[model samples]
Target chain A: MAMKIGEGKFKENVNKNMEDTFMRGAVAGAQERLRTRRLDAAEELGNWEEWRSHGEEIRKHVLDNLDYYLHELAENLQKRGGHVFFAETADEATGYIREVVNANGGKKILKAKSMVTEEISLNQVLEQEGCKVIETDLGEYILQLDEHDPPSHIVAPALHKNKEQIRDVFSDKLDYKMTSKPEELALHARETLRQEFLTADIGITGCNFAIAESGSVGLVTNEGNAGLVSDLPKTQIAVMGMERIVPTFEEFEVLVGLLTRSAVGQKLTSYITALTGPREEGDADGPEEFHLVIVDNGRSKILGTEFQSVLQCIRCAACINVCPVYRHIGGHSYNSIYPGPIGAVLTPLLGGYDDFKDLPYASTLCAACTDACPVKIPLHELLHKHRQVIVEREGRAPISEKLAMKAFGLGAASNPMYAAGSKMAAAMMKPFTKNDRISSGPGPLKAWTEIREFPAPNKERFRDWFKQHEKGGGEQ
Target chain B: MKVTLFITCIVDMFQADVGKATVEVLERLGCDIKFPMGQVCCGQPAYNSGYVEESKDAMKKMITTFENAEIIVTPSGSCATMFKEYQRIFHNDPVWRPRAERLAVKTYELTEFIVHVLGVENIGAKLNGVATYHPSCHMTRLLGVKDAPMTLLQNVEGLRFEPLPNAHNCCGFGGTFSVKMGNISEQMVDEKVDSAEQTGADFLIGADGGCLMNIGGRIERRGKPIRVMHIAEVLNSR
Candidate 1:
């Protein structure tokens, strides 16, 4: 699957998602649950701020010394007989992965859910070569079963789908008679996936953080599917964004703690596995031949830019959970595999403004996402930067908005213009005023009136009132 | 304390009563109030919309307008936050950056000024009603003025305070957003109005005029009995 999931315009996707009451309810419920859990987890830590700061430091340090760490990680991994390919583009990344799959004569590949893999459209590449790639993560597996349904959320791929929906998908595809209880559905999925896990020709997992010092790739998951995906197959490939590297195991531990708490509000997920290279002689588990594909895909462009901090993200959806926009519109509205505030920022950088220009403006600049970010990425600020780029640099903004904003700047900056504008507001709004509120209006007011009543411009401006009140000696 | 009023554009043109209450509240606390007529909008409507270069004109106007005031105060937390933002906005400008810094340090949201600067929790205000507060996102999250609103509200005589469900969420009046993405803003504001209704409160109080207008406008359209109020107006109650 591609990074951009749903077809049509961003607004079209939003309107469609907004109309889906089932999806909206599911998203809101999950947001509340995850939000509370994250808060509780952070509260349990008693020093979440410190932990967050540490996480930010580690990620920032890694990003700053990325080249050194990448070289070191690659050297150490190759020393342990692992193949490391650094792909500066998505096409190159997918090309190398396809070569590995073809070389191994891979079919029926077992995969741990990975946003990077979704980003690079690896599954589509493999499928074109006639490979049946199975999504092992429960959320991803549910989506995969539903005829390649694009994931709505990053961590919880099927977050927009309720249990009943999942059960329906399973019943239609797997033809199983089972209750909608999560346990029952999961058990059935587990039973179905167990054989595929053991017999898959190749195992592919997403790396949470590539440990440079130990040359190990860490996988953090609640499902423990990563362990099985990397262990059961003779050939294994781990894909990671180039920026997802840590200096050593020490920084890795710190980040994993922050990631789990922020994403699921757990102290640590059910399984946190860090594997170093291929299995040695007499090793019980792990692949004999391992390949690491480090995908750049437009990340380096942000390194020295104002958005350098965005690369510090640990893929924790804490920002997504707290976002009011994401709460109302739901994840599918974002259209990218990386949804919510992060998507609004990253998608434009990777996918370009042609498709994602409106993504940045989708936010209210509430800073909830910024506050929720464990690694201290200024998500809201980055979003604002996108807007500036669209208007100032890109010149993609509508001419009407450009004119209106230009007028706003002039009226606001000059005292005479502001006074005339303020003085004329009430008079200009008179025709629309009804009982001190503009129920219907013009221009921007037309949009405002469509949703909510617009307040009639006060006949007496506050400055005029203040002048009179001061003449009355500021009497109450 | 001498206080200069930066009554935000929404208050100046639309919600004058909010500005009035803010002045009265500060005056009763024995602080001298200054109203600089040159003050206009905080450039947020433009700035937040991505017209950063255009927004600087207004930001500079604001900086110059309140340049001489000992301390600046506004009823809107979001506007106050914007005032604070000017420093960072002009961080690289050698000419305006220092001036922006001076203005930011002295600026305060009304509730913040009353509680933090005035050092008074309550001003002997009394309001008998069931009410809840909607903390505007920029106020609580950006400005970090979370406690001041509650501290004063909790001390108000005869006011029954029930927390609004999902109080941390935005009221969906993101200046331009309510207009640009009206559909999404509609959903958000409707949910906010529903949450306030869930509280069964007579009044829904907020610290920002823009948020009040959004929530209040929806409450009006839906014809809910709940009265939308500004925290300044609520605190100004006798």
Candidate 2:
């Protein structure tokens, strides 16, 4: 229920995830499907890079003047007869949302897929007040039925589970006997959820993007459940991260295009719903009382810092899809609701390094995430920045690593130390060297040797070889 | 064309044969090779781990060492990418940033140097074996040397190139990441080796020594019968 999901060392989590062949198969299959779909969509879109740049520019512009846009958004929403609350912390945000439900005499809230609500833990707060909460999104419904299982991915909440697992969850909770086919499961979930939506007093949804100029919230979904959640219930509440707003519809269009393509490789999502305030006098099926909660939590602190570029993220998960680390470990290993490259950088900042110190080092610095990112977040570099903070600022890096790095710093920066280190390298590794390869190595080499052979230090260093060749004029 | 070889520290001490092959291959392709002895390391190992202060000394050493060379070339893509990274590292220092840019402008990975700079696609090399190339992340993405290695290898006589499954994935040889997060690194390398085996290639060829060493070491330990060779070694072979 806390921010950390798979809380432990990254290696232990990875080992645990790797052992779960079922989960691995599910993750790898999803990644392959999503990766190809994303690539094909981008190729079809044509000038995907230009669109990405435009999206990045719009996000940067919005973030640069976030205060102005937030005010403009609040003003426009207030004009349209909607209540707006800015919560600076998670406690405040959840507290405000609970009060809204209490004032409305709400019980049995029907919720659409919303990451921000999960991030702020809003459902638990409402449930503690003794309200029945039902998740309407198909993936979310399965996870909610399975004793509120944590979402592994942003787009696919139950990404770690295959249809068989979903069927088991549905069979046990819903007591339905059916095949593990997706359509069968989806139909069963829809039948079960339809009744909940009809009786629910309130609906909660996360805003994909908020239009500041018109005070409209945009929701992009494949299932169209979000539209039902927002419109069916008499009382509706939308929760959004403060950075999720756009200045105008033009900027919103660019971002939605980039988001749909980058996230699941769709030119356009099946449903793109934009709702403004509440239903008017002439309106046909919609919520009457609407409230918008813009939660800052820890985002404001990152506004002007070096990490501001991270805010440009559209939650596309292209970075996550291509990440080598995420490919093997799946999302839970990251120990946060958010995982992969973005999570590695974002989690530690939001939750602090004490709980997620290892997240930064979880990457191989492969820059695969950096390349895959549509908005050009430089995710790998941001991850490195976390390491810098952990080491130089927080001083939380393992003492052994710090000591080793210190020695490396002294040895690497100076010519004499490097020369001496390179000279004595062959002898130092002699005990481990066999047939010119160190099959079993020592110290740092131990980890490498666990799976692969470590090449022994050459008898004659390249410096020596180069010097000899130079003196002898180039012949081997 | 005269090319100065920045034999990365790994190639300098651990994989000297790779450096030798690189020199031979470049020379065979009509390059006059110059070994810059003062070039000890590219400072990447420290720089990447956020030891900027520590890495600066090596960066300065390299800038001075290869300052006079007509064109700087290296056997490692990761290391060559490090040359491209120098400007960013010295962004605050006006004097060093320009010098770093100059180094980056002239630097290339061995295959890139041979194919792009020298305009030599075929070097008359013969290796009668099916090989799959692992395009290291730094080389293909960061350094943007994607097609040069493939272009050169396509012209190699008697060599059958197989496509590596999941070739775009990292080999889990993230320099210190191999040892720092050894458990994760082990799993990643295992998967990489598995993918290479699926290719049915006799050998795994790569541009960077770091990747080759990782994949090669795993192949050796598992006794997979798949030989791992650097691009230079593959290109130099006849």
Candidate 3:
């Protein structure tokens, strides 16, 4: 129910996720489909690289002057009669929202898919206050209906579930008989959510990007649920990570272009609603009261550090879509609402090493996520930075690994040590070698050998063979 | 052209045949190759494992080892990519930074050197078999050597090449990752092998030794008929 999903340990989570053949199939299928679609969309949008660069530049600029833009945004929002709250922590953000809901005597709350709210565990907090919180986004609605299944992915909250799984969840919870076809399942969810939209006293949505110039919060969605969440409710609360800000509409337009194309391979989502302040007089349909809660929750700590670039993320999930590790392990393995590459990097920073130490090491340093990032966050490098921190500063790495690395460093750095080690490797490994392979190895080799045969160390090392050939003592 | 061979530690200690094939192929291409005896590991194994300070010593040793070469070449794309990484690793040290940068600029993977430097795609090599190439992640994605191997492979006479499905994915041979995250690594390598088998190729070819070792080891264990060959071995074949 919190940012850290299940109670299982990191390894246990991964092992469990690995065994779920159904989830694995669903994740693999989605990855292949999403990866190809992203490529096609990028190809369609000529000069995608330039757009990415522009997106990167805009984010970097905003981050560099985040204080300035935050002030400007707050001022403009206040000028247009919108209450703004700067929450430095998750507790503060959730507490502020609860106060507002209680003040309004709100019993029912309608919500769009908002990761920040999930990160803060707002729904649970509200429910404990005897308030009924209903998720209106199709994915979030399914998850909410199924006794609060934590989101597996950022964009597709219910990505781990197949249509069949959704149908079962809907049938069991809502007493609706429906086929596993997507249209039927979606219609069933839509019909149920429409009633909540009309009746809810308050609505909560996550901001995709807040435009500083006009003090408008932008929401990009395929289901058009965010528009209803904002327009229908009397008091609408938009929660955002403080870093999700653009300096102006120009930058907002550039980022939105990158976000849609990168997230779901769409040129544009079905709806991109930008609501500035509560509403002007004579407005057709809009929230009478609007509140923007900018939640830091340890983000500001990353501002001046080596990982500041991570703040440039547009919540696109392009990195998640392309990550090979995520493809096999699935999103639940990450054990966070924000899964995949971004989650691996951000979770430890927000949640600390006690719970999330293994997330950084979860990668193979393949840089696939880095390549896929719309804003070019250099994700793999950041992951490595986390490793460096864990090893050097935190001292969280295992003692055995530390000892092995020390020996490795000494041997690799010294020419004599390396030569001697190389020469002695074959003899040392001879006991385990059989038919040019070690089917079962010892020490570190055990892990590798468990899955595949390890090559027997060559008795005649390449250097020796090359030396013999140079003297004409061996055949070429 | 004179090329100093940085036969990576993997080739020197484990897969010596890959190194031999690389030398023969380069020599046949009219290259005067020099073996840098002082060369050691590229420091990647330590660097990637988060032992940055410990790895720098090895990196500095490598930079000095190939200091005088006109061009340094290696059989392993991942190692060559590590050579390029030396610059970033030493960015803080003023003296070693420039040296690392110089070392990176002249270093090339064997196939990259052959196709890009020598301007030769086909060396008239012949091998009769259906083969699929696994573009190792570090080599193709980091070093940006995507086209060179394919350029040469397309020209190998009598060799029918089938593209490996989901070729862009990592083979789970992320050095220490194979050992540390063995469970996840198994799944990844298994998927890679499945894709390679799906191509119905008789041989699996790869530019990096680490990838070949992982995938090849799995194929051997599974008792699959597919043979794994280094790109160097394939190019050297007659």
Best-performing candidate as measured by lDDT = 3
Q: What TM value does the first chain of each candidate achieve? A: 0.98, 0.98, 0.99
Worst 10 residues of 1 chain B by lDDT: B162-171
- Candidate 2: segments with Cα more than 4 A from true spot: A473-475
lDDT of 2 by residue, A171-207 (tens): 8999989999999999998888888878889999999
Candidate 1 segments whose C-alpha is farther than 4 A from its true place:
A473-475
Fraction of true A-B contacts recovered by candidate 2: 0.74
| Every model's TM-score | 0.99, 0.98, 0.99
Interface RMSD list for the candidates = 0.8, 1.3, 0.7
Classify candidate 3 by CAPRI docking class: high
Question: Which portions of model 3 show Cα errors greater than 4 Å?
Answer: none
Q: Write the per-residue lDDT of candidate 1 for residues B1-238, one digit (tens) a residue.
A: 8889999999999998888888888888998988988888899999999999998999998999999999988898899999999989999999999999999899988888888888999888899999998999999999999999999999989999888888888888888999999999999999999999999999999888999999999999999999998988888998
lDDT of 2 at B183: 77
Q: Write the per-residue lDDT of candidate 1 for residues A17-123, one digit (tens) a residue.
A: 88899888888898899999999999998888899888888988898899999999999999999999999999999999999999999988999989999999999
- Cα lDDT tens digits, model 3, B1-238, are 9989999999999999998998889889998879978989989988998899989889989999999999999998899999999898889899999999999999999999998899998889999999999998898889989999989998999999898999999998888999999999999999999999999999999999999999999999999999999999999999
Worst 10-residue lDDT window for candidate 2 chain A reads: A1-10
Count backbone overlaps in model 2: 1
- Each model's DockQ score: 0.89, 0.75, 0.86
Ranking by DockQ: 1, 3, 2
